[model samples]
Target: MLYRPNPPISFTGAVLDRADHIRADADKLAELMNWRARLLRLDGLDPVIGDDGALVWGTLADAGEHDELVFLGLDESGRACFAPVSPANKGNPGPANPRLWGAMASLPAGDLATYGGARALVDWHARHRFCARCGYTTKLGKGGWQRKCVNMDCKAEHFPRVDPVTIMSVEWEGNLLLGRQPRFPAKRYSALAGFVEPGESIEEAVAREVHEEAGVRVRDVRYVACQPWPFPSSLMIGCHAYADDPAITIDKTELEDARWFTRDEVVYAMEALKTGAEDGAFIAPPPFAVAHHLLKWWIEQ
Candidate 1:
């Protein structure tokens, strides 16, 4: 069965038509890059919002001759949209202003989606400027969708990569498994997660990560929902399972703390989402995070 998350998800509902058909057609793409083309305004990966509380856009004229263009998609009016990635940000991004969160939260859904996709593509191009197979320099191709090696002998093409990660809620009796990494805010806890390694299915990854991090065995692994986390690009795969036993032996290398929370405790945090109440066992993740939605799905069960 397909997993559906309520309340929708951030970065999922993009309004642009990602006209892939034109990406490889140089002539067709050039035709779209006329005066009507729109350019997203980004400051070192952070968004630039207009006074109207929407993502600010400029024109192709703003692009510098050296700027590498990433085709975002076509806007509502079928006008082409693009983002010019500055080489200064290649493999390096600045720390966002603290208020970036608020700005992103206020953006319209479609705008947010456009920004996420554009950000991922631009960042990828910046970091992967060389052929992995031959150690030769590479240049943008396929309308920024791919990179081609300058060395004809090693013409390896590269594409944007989205690493798969497994984040899951494991249940025993009526309690849910939650953990806090060292970097997490104090008194905040969420689902256990780890990268999905090669040679494993989602079910295997969920089971393996839960065991490795919390020393707990799980069964009846199942899918829940997923989120596109574009912090350098990752796909957060959410899942649910039942614990064979609730005893947790924390892997300090991976987590600062791991424990089980009662259903009532999770219920309390969900309530805190609206009330801003901090007296609960631990602060639930923000509404936009897949972990928060996974907890919501858990309590509904």
Candidate 2:
């Protein structure tokens, strides 16, 4: 049996309608203050979780005074939604879940999408407290979707950014090329990935990344899928590319190792990782990752 996890966060679930025009309306803003509206509380980037392995949401009344709240659109039922960033609880006492792993633990699609979006937005806000153009403090605007510099002389607006990354599984003949970064766990290897440089198309980025990191030329760059990677906001564009040559010249500065793996090796590695086998020659990315799906697609072909 083939193992496939739920679609990556931000790609699944129904997000609220971003009612942009009504955001500035006083009456509509007041309507969000109703007690029935839901609030997602975050401590830094981590969400507050409940005992049932779900995000702990509450009404506006339950929010802390110091919380920085952002309107996160209305749900299908028309209930207003907001996400508040609170100070990190040092002790993380009682039911507070860890960031990444906790979020992946069987969360409902709606909650996962909400958490992913909130984390990205709050992260941007934290990093962009001051404007780059004039070095003035910025204020939130457009329901937290944008920030504007406070300096009257040079009021510059800033918006949240999602960095695009091209993650590709390069195949040569019957084998796939996988590499491991220095930061990766021992014996683990996955697809080659790099940030999409400005002015470069997605296909161009894939070819350049594979060549730059492994000294392998590739062609036929084909799009597979995309995932919202909210570790400081990245959109992972998955692809498959055909390698022109099998030889690999690893860039030690970028990767610890780069090599080709046979089909059987990949299949066994995936199976081992899925079954929680402690000992294995190779370990692939977990099912939640786009790399895993890329590999699965390749294996099924």
Candidate 3:
């Protein structure tokens, strides 16, 4: 599917992502430790507090010496900035929680994803302060990879999480199935989606979520693509499914309305928004949204 590339940072897994992986490693970043955790107050920068209640922008001092891989947060124009931390007057600047700064969801979407990972790590540390088994506070271990319980008797380790969900555009006859939740804005409908439960396959999730959310029976479910949705972290698995029938039964609790849209109508709604046409009546999601991707594929088909 082709559309304008969403800017700030393209989260799509592609050749460009190779650079991200190379940069994701914090080991190489330690080389900058001498410059890390400098008092931004001295530099005329007032540190901001993040959503997690931690003052943002601290040097990753805990990151060992001579490392060069530093994960950076970029602005809308792709200019990168050092996420600074607290304890500025001297000494090792206290670790500032960058995660707290990530809550400004209105920022550009690419920054949201980048800082979302940072915040997820910080949140993980704050929440896992203690071991579930021994109640002993844990320590950040393995270069922010794991949290090890401090109590020797009940040592426990925890890792970052990414919940997986299956989202699908169901097709039957010549119409594409779409649904609108009560919370959706007027004229907004999106693909049916639900988290993949333990022991459930992607195909199973597509079939199950379709039936549970819309009472529609799916015949064949095929995986298309996936996106990293980091609103507290979730991997959205996109798919296309064939519905067995055209009958609609609404799951009122989950969706306000469930129905089918002809490919022409989908195209009209999108093109209307694109060309500023007068008669275009439908409202689709933003270009960055997975719903837009699904619609792009549908219209192309």
Candidate 4:
């Protein structure tokens, strides 16, 4: 079944046709990069929004000879879309600059999704400049969809990778489990989450994270929804589970606090999404996060 939330998750509604087969066709890819092709305008890995709050685009004419162009995909009109690699922003660990977030907030969901994908793709290309296997300089290949080592004897190839993270709500006695990381804004509490480790299933990761972070055993883990979080590329797997014990022994190393919230408190926080309200039991996550939709789905149930 297709997991559809009331409103689609932030970066999952892209309208682009990611033509994967064309990446391997050198002649076809080159043909698509004509004067009609569009280039996404970016500022240090951030989007460059036009006055109308839409993603600003340019033509192939705007590109420099030295630029390394990444094929984003095909637009609705079948015109090719691309983004150039920026040296300064390639390996940047970003939640994005505060000002960029404001500009991004104004973007339409589709544009935001497109930009998120482009940002992640280009970032990966920039950071991975050497062959992991051979430690040789890597050159862009497959229309920037892959990296190939320059060493003749130790030829190697690499592709972009996304880390999987599990974010979940643990319910017990009708209360939802929420926690705050030290980096979160004051009073902000959202679903508990952690990266999925190797040799673990999603269900196991959810249960393990819950017990490790809050000392609460959870079972009956079920997927809720997911969001592509491009803070250097991560897929946030949203889920829900039942907790046998409400008791929380916060792992001070992982969280600043962990607690259960009543249905009334959660409803109050959900309503605050618009006004950016504080002074409640805790600040709820913004709509951009899958946590918000997961919590919203829980409320609907």
- Quick one: best lDDT, which candidate? 4
Q: What is the lDDT of candidate 3?
A: 0.59
Question: What are the lDDT scores of the predictions, listed in order?
Answer: 0.88, 0.79, 0.59, 0.88
**Candidate 1 Cα deviation (angstroms), residue 145:** 0.9
Model 2 segments more than 4 A misplaced = 1-11, 24-26, 86-99
lDDT of 4 by residue, 29-128 (tens): 9999898999999886888888898999999887767668899899999999999885555567666556665755678999999998998888888789
Per residue, candidate 3 scores C-alpha lDDT tens digits across 167-269 of 8989998788988888776787788889899998999988999999888899778876677754445778878989877888888888898888888877887
Question: Stretches of candidate 1 above 4 Å error?
Answer: 1-3, 92-99
Where does candidate 3 have its weakest 10-residue lDDT segment?
Answer: 38-47
Q: Candidate 2 residues 1-301, lDDT tens each?
A: 3434445433346467777776677587787778778887665567777777777878888777875567888878888888765433222112223446546656777777777777777777767778999898888776678888999998898998889999999999889999998877689899999999999999999999999999999999998878887776788998999987898899999999998999998999999976888576589987667888898888888
For model 3, what is the error of residue 40's alpha carbon versus the real structure, in angstroms, after optimal superposition? 13
The pairs that clash in candidate 2 are none
Model 4 TM-score (2 dp): 0.96
Q: In candidate 1, what are the lDDT values of residues 121-172, reduced to their tens digit? A: 8888888888999999999888889999999888899998888999999999
Q: Which model, 2 or 4, shows the larger TM-score?
A: 4
TM value for model 3: 0.69
